[model samples]
Target: MKRKNVKLMMLAALFPMLCWAAGEQPISLGTPTGEIQGRVMLPDVERPPVVLIIAGSGPTDMDGNSLLGAVTLKNNSLKLLAEGLARRGIASLRYDKRGIASSAAAGKEEKDLRFDDYVADARGWIELLSEDSRFSGIFVVGHSEGSLIGMLASEGNAKVKGFVSIAGAGHPAYEIIETQMSNQPAEVRQLVKNINDSLRAGKAVNDVPVGLMALYRPSVQPYLMSWYRYDPREVVACLEQPVLLVQGDKDIQVSVGDAEALKAAQPQAELHLIENMNHVLKSCDTVDAGVQQATYTNPDLPVVEELLNVIEKFIKP
Candidate 1:
């Protein structure tokens, strides 16, 4: 649960698709919130299933970029995923959440970002595909933090034919945050717990620690509270369509236990655990901490074979 490895992969030497890459045509999808901007990569085949690629947390751009420094990986994981899926005859649509990239217009920006806003946005994408006769099926692929959002959005939506929860958390956001903060000093942990407890109780805390102000600040608390309300395990349990739950063992951001929890909630889900794969969905040995982390920023590395195989089998079979 501490790792985002649940974030995504498995294609080895699949660069052949790169030569045939669709190059991701720019797309502006209309939604209830506003205009959602993203790129659409289609396979050469006809009647392909369309995948809506949802990115993880933070300020991740459409191509899996974080303008906020510290994340230097320009490999374009989402873009590459779209390419790989396209090669396998699956088209994909990946976009920046509300205010990040092309969707940063005044009326459509993140003035008051909430968890449900993303869910609604995802449904908007589903509605778009439902109108397109070319796509016979619509799938929602949620990675890292997007797993929860995808699950909630696709659960009862008739337009979404399948759900893929990658590197998603099975626990509630409060428990996940608490697990992430386990190494913190007792005082800091208690402060976070108190704040979350108050928020869960439908109360807001005005006094906050300077150190944790960024995470629990007044502006972000409402979204955090909304996020904590939706338990991923509960959300997955409600999904009636086929589900593919995939996790990377060496993922530093998400843990295997989260995937197992998801499987427990939905016994029928097809679960695949990839060994030596990090959260970003790259195939490589995790013996060295630096190498493990390097894949996050490695642009040349391709998705592992195992990932592509399962995804293709799930969607085409």
Candidate 2:
């Protein structure tokens, strides 16, 4: 449960069958509004453990890529992660959340979207996997915002044997947003704080400043209110299954402190802090802004090896 440096070569030597072939198939789950789309990677083994991969926030797709304006943030983090797990003889399913990519049709109007909708979708996936005979165990791996969603869904679910939180925030969404805005001008920071406080209190602010409108807009306020209600530490503590908390020392978004807080909340949870891993799960040698940006946009980079190692051990141990 403590942080340790893992040698890639050593892990490779210990698990020699790291190149096993895995079959990829498109999977779907029907929701009340529409269908949620996903990909299932099944290794060539009978009754392998299946991990339900939940992606991060925003327009991120199943492959962990999101669109920023006209350009695409093309890191295939989740896709490569699923493939890595499959190669390790573990099955995985990564899905595009509603309002994202192929699942766009399943999205409701912004005002109608609530954080619990995502939790419901995750639970639906759990039910679908529970009835499948190919998978012997069910595990949930959530990254960033998805981490909290996975915790909520996995809590009290008998089918989920384990849970993994990667680059997940330990605090509520509002607090994290406030911390990220710490360097802004005092007035701007105060504006954001006031809005966040209102949202956290389940109240909607009608007049958001022009500069902050995109983030605190009236249409998105309801979803923000729903999201800010849950404290990640509290939720993770409620989970009865084994938990693995993984953080990257190099990650700028979610700090090592957040992972430590999560581990503290759940004393029995295992925690691993991988060296040089970034928010996108790729290894970056420097914290240079440009280099970090490149890691986010590069699709060729594989996820950090230590991450896959820690996860494999947690799932198979």
Candidate 3:
């Protein structure tokens, strides 16, 4: 018997809901540790090349919701992106990072984790994909912190076709954090400095200002330490495979300079700088901090079609 393509074409419903893109049903990939849940959207015909989408930092869910409340991608980014790919005859896997969503089923807390543990979990996902007959080859798509996760997971995986970084940092994590801190008001800057000093002195930042707890939570120090050891530019420089570096020109949290740094590090990397796009890939009214926060929780906002088009072209069979 011939195998049918698992991809589903989502058109504007023949009439009523035709314009809105249809989403996919959730699925799971069982690993040694626990089951990781994700949604798979494939074209209605044949199975398409698959892409694995990883979420960014903080308490972000699979749908791109951050705990900050000030920011929300109105729509579930991973879910919508996957469904969009399916509409284009492509497939995608968007899973909650360990300690997030369905993966949280394991009861392991993010605060008690290390950076290497994430790399390991990513590797497990890769291994799962390789063993599954459904996918042809996987493209590792990492957003923000996930970009680093993808690079670390792809180190020697021949099954990984390429790597994509969306709003990824170009410098070391702490360096970027320090740069971000410098832009804060004087009081906040001083408090940030104190926390950094405490961390540098090998003391817990618990004694510092309450404002710094976001960065100093006890359960997350090991992961922070592991993340601090890596330089993103160097990692991209050393990658043996093709890379796609996408950044938003209007992103305040991550500057366009970061994108330039990545290009400088890997002259051959494909760079796409979208105008008016923010860190979350949504079109922005302005790049100002205040305006950006206002849209964080508005899931109705749509991502720039340009980004989806570029990604589709890159991952197509």
- Measured by TM-score, the strongest candidate is 2
Across 177-265, the per-residue lDDT of candidate 1 in tens digits comes to 99899999999999999999988886777898899888888877777877778889989999998999999898878889999999999
* Model 2 lDDT per residue over 28-72, tens place: 999999999999999889779999999999899999999878999
Backbone clashes for every candidate come to 16, 0, 19
Question: TM-score of each candidate?
Answer: 0.89, 0.92, 0.81
Q: Which ten residues in a row have the lowest lDDT in candidate 1?
A: 7-16
Tell me model 1's lDDT, rounded to 2 decimals: 0.82
lDDT of each: 0.82, 0.93, 0.75
- Which residue runs does candidate 3 get wrong by more than 4 Å? 1-23, 31-33, 69-74, 183-214
Q: How far is candidate 2 from the true structure (C-alpha RMSD, Å)?
A: 10.2
TM-score, predicted candidate 2 vs. hidden true structure: 0.92
After aligning candidate 1 to the native by TM-score, how far in Å is the CA of 35 from where it should be? 1.7
The reply for model 2, stretches above 4 Å from the true place, is 1-22
- Please write out the lDDT profile of model 3 over residues 207-270, one tens digit for every residue: 6556677676776665666677788888888877788899888887788888889889989889
Ten-residue stretch with the least lDDT total in model 3: 1-10
For model 3, state the Cα shift of residue 217 in Å: 4.0
Q: Which candidate achieves the best lDDT against the true structure?
A: 2
